[model samples]
Target: MEIELSLPEPDPAEQDREVIETLINDSKYTSFAAKYLREHKSEIDQLIKMKTKFGNTWKDVVKTGLRVPNSKVGFYATDADCYDVFGDPLKYVVHSHNMRDADPNAIPQRVVGGDQLSLQVSDACKERIISARCRFARNLTNYVFPTSISPKDRVAAEAELKAALDKLTGDLAGTYTKMGDLSQEEQDKMVENHQLFHNKDEFLVKGDFYDDWPNGRGQFHNNDGTVMVWVGEEDHIRCMSLEKGSDISSCYNKATKMLEHLDKHVGLAHHKDFGWLTSCPTNVGTGMRASVHISLPRIKANMPISELKDICKKNNLDIRGTGGENTGFAGVVFDVSNRRRFDVALSRCHY
Candidate 1:
């Protein structure tokens, strides 16, 4: 049929007026709400009064199931669909986007992507301009009232604020553009790889041996040059034996004896800096727990699960869920036990 369909062009001036109006109204309403809250003094009672006074205002601004702008992904604003425009118009207007199929590379991407697109500014340059305008307006409102400002004064301040805000918003947008964004996953990985240890000072471990090799002395130096020493070979060996515990009781005994010897020989001043070296809430009653990284793939699929549980129990090892409860996702648990010793220094011999 040789017929073409086209959307009508929006009036630029009219749209600009609408955006200016929205920003101004938002500022005014917010100021009014703030003043009301101040007057009420009691937040709970004030909130109840506000809800009653502006119940219909909420309905006009918000729509059901509509996500508010700038609220972040996977989360919604409280009472998002409710209007209460006087309360926080900035929240409502900031999220309002009008652009269909907004480009990711668009100028002022933050503003255009969601509810921000509804502003009167140009598609190419408006987002930043509007953001600047909004910021300036809010700042001016705060400046005028300091305490007792009227809603009309706040609205009047928008034009002056818009100019300043636009400039600042543009500068900010440019900065953001220069710093290319990384995906959330990449950011998480970077955070996870950050260094865990911060202490660089030396620490001492001391203990007395009770067995044939009593009076054994050992010292461990960390990469940071921190040193810890324990007196007595049996105490040192008992500490090392934490990983080879036949039962929890045996592990506890060795850990306790090691600590006692350390206290007697070196004293708390020497090794107290090391968190693991001291008796804390988690390891207080049990000392340090040794954990072994095990590969679960070695276990046969057809083997009876009950036998595995019994074997673990006999070995004095606690069975733990890797991914899901009872169902083994990984072939083995990272075998962890407390009642054993960790060789702090390779050069130091255990009792």
Candidate 2:
């Protein structure tokens, strides 16, 4: 049975085949992967086209479309992963997590524990992992979405949140002040606390968030700097708290308590079925984004961006830059956060 039959030479074009093709065509796929291939046919086509024409971003595909509820398939790839894979001279991966939910129908919601894990950033920063921050947002009942709201309404909503800060005076122990008033050192201090957001989110900009400027915008942090509240950032009220180490118990306690106190005092807008409603449909549920900042010196020195990203995705985490959303790296600081928000109980997110 050791017969040697002459075979045709391999085609040069097929020699370096795309990984996507292997994923789609391989019969050795497990039931999960096989079902994945069948369900994401259109996305697969897009990936193949990218591979054949421009370049393929396996990290983006996996991170945005992996194991989680309401997986964001067709997620636009960011150049950040490309930079990470190429080992950008200026930055390295960091780990952070976020818990968020949105109530709406435009974006498809996934079943319990569906595709939503991307792990490159978290793995790179595992050894250097520092701490986790948990946060959430709530919009007011009267005001329309920030995108559609007039300048007058924006100010009104901002004023409302500013008033709510007082309700937290004793329990949370923080002062409310404008960002511009904070000096350079103070601003830098806030940055480390994950309490400072200098610019507006891009989605907000396209929706005309700058119409009223920072007139009503302000930040609040507790004495020890573990708690924070953003008035007039992207949402009407965004409460956040970040701890110094990966102590989920402590971090979650501060975050939930902050929300609990604020909700009791100033009532977060909510719908019966949808839970918390945010400006972005993506953040309608728990509206919590829990993340940790980590440093990855060795991974920065050893791997290519693509392979590094691949490792992270395999591990079920996501890597976003310090400045956030494609503003380039922040040296070695990265935000690694939980990607699943729907299907799972909000309480379970801490686990």
Candidate 3:
């Protein structure tokens, strides 16, 4: 089924034409939202009036860019924002996904590769690889995106996930710790170790993701901490697996196993047009990001950051700081991950 969107009559007085025009013209404003608004000035009126079934409007979609002119993604509250409010912007979408083109008739399906005994990297490349991680954003088929989910429903969703997690046995047995129950020290350690998520992200904050603070937000990790999941983040759930060195197979296998268990109990949302529905369009397809932390001192020393970025683009890889997206690399250690998240075979997407 298609997403629902409303095109209400444009309100002239609500159009902050000159104000938006000025921001779009600012050199610091280079996010996707800014670019879209600048190029489609005429659609501002319609965009302002457009609303998703959950009541997200253009203001919700572009607030990130307006609030932080230098924001990378800008942001979108729901899946419908991609086609309904943003006009699809085929060029931008395809480019963002690092795909060749968008074929209207094509229905891309997700194909995951989770071999437990295989490694994805070459022996030589493995030397520089510090760790491997696999994670995917997921939402429930019956629930609205986090940005629009009511507090009561959000709590219900978390309870449902907790029940499913409680059923996990063997290596997957663990605890679900709510953000509200975490102490300052506990939160700090998790953040330092990259085991927890914070609600302070400007983009998500502007998108209205942390409505009731940490009421329904929490995280679950296996006894060993290798396999984990974040509940009520940007998406309804984010399943992850981490392994030392370049063990893609183990990472993928563990994450996929947890995801399958969750799916068996709580059903994940999926669509023909968008393999896995998510809060943001960028993660629509597989919604998976498989990455490796590696030391690249030689490359860092010899090539400029811009040149290295171009090379990464050519190779369908994205390099970021060890801290994650929008952060700068820490010395020579960098997080290298797949750039194409949509329209690609999931099996191949991870490699």
Candidate 4:
């Protein structure tokens, strides 16, 4: 006798079945993302096939469209203000019409970017390495995800950010160049600078983000390349500051100064409860990351990669190869960084 089996009912509201199925049918989902969703189908409230302005959304695409993975990834599809639109969890509901509302009493800003990131990585440290970096993602209030960000929106936003950069004098003074406007030679040089990583984002594979080829993407950096802001790289803006050693305060100051200036003049995405808002949930809170690169010759020589990675994982640390993730490690140097971005304070990241 044949037996009938019952499958759990799917959540109608979790995801738009039509779009999810369509992307799957079209082979737009990454093997990793598709496989991941399929394996953990239960934890997912919904499988959203979202649209970004430039690239496709990946959670560790939030890496986050909720850049997913990295210990805790901010799933963009579910957490996006438009997708789920969760308002202040306390004053509002999980998926409200608006999530940008900020509380009056909440701190206007988190850390003073430049204050805490001033220390330099010492030469005498056990690992002989110390560097600090703070990166942030910002979204505009008017646009949907990057998928739907209109050309007009991209141009206007770029102009606004560039204008702010122009206003700054001294180290912050610089020019904003659009990807579409650069000459082939300049573009090649930019790529060879070793500053910008090749966009190997999985979302690009899934979403065809390069369809127009540099429609609105651009970069803003100081002459020394110390202060750089990637225009339309991941989110609308990837504000970053790099420094040698562990002077996190200096790094934060450089990046935050730009963000604050823009926030005051143009505005940024933020919520009272969630702090900063982005396509990735992991990036939502303070929208800040502090990282250090340590050359652990002793540790690398003594420990296996698997074992060493495991130890870092247990302690809320993230590691990347010396040459970054895709490329193999460069000798013994490794990119070690904090694991959490939400709720956790900036100071704890250093600890």
Which has the greatest TM-score?
3
Every model's TM-score = 0.20, 0.58, 0.81, 0.71
Q: Per-residue lDDT for 65-130 in model 4, tens only?
A: 222223222234322454333221212211122224433444225433444444554557634656
lDDT of 2 by residue, 142-177 (tens): 555454456776777666766667666655777888
Clash totals in order: 38, 42, 0, 52
Better of 3 and 4 by lDDT: 3
Question: How many collisions between residues are there in candidate 3?
Answer: 0
Ranking by TM-score: 3, 4, 2, 1
In model 3, how large is the Cα lDDT of residue 195? Answer: 89
Q: Which of candidates 2 and 4 reaches a greater TM-score?
A: 4
Between prediction 1 and prediction 2, the one with superior TM-score is 2
Q: Model 1, residue 158: displacement in angstroms?
A: 50
- All candidates' lDDT scores? 0.25, 0.53, 0.76, 0.58
Give the winner by lDDT: 2 or 4. Answer: 4
Model 1 Cα lDDT, one tens digit per residue, 1-351: 698989899854454334333423443333222223234444332222232121322222221111222211111111212222133332222222111221223211111112211213244332211111000000111122111123453333333332222333211211111001334454345334321111111111111012121111122212231112221111111132222212323323333333344333323211111112211111211123333334343353655656766766565444444331233545544332222122222111011
lDDT of 3 at 147: 77
TM-score of 4: 0.71
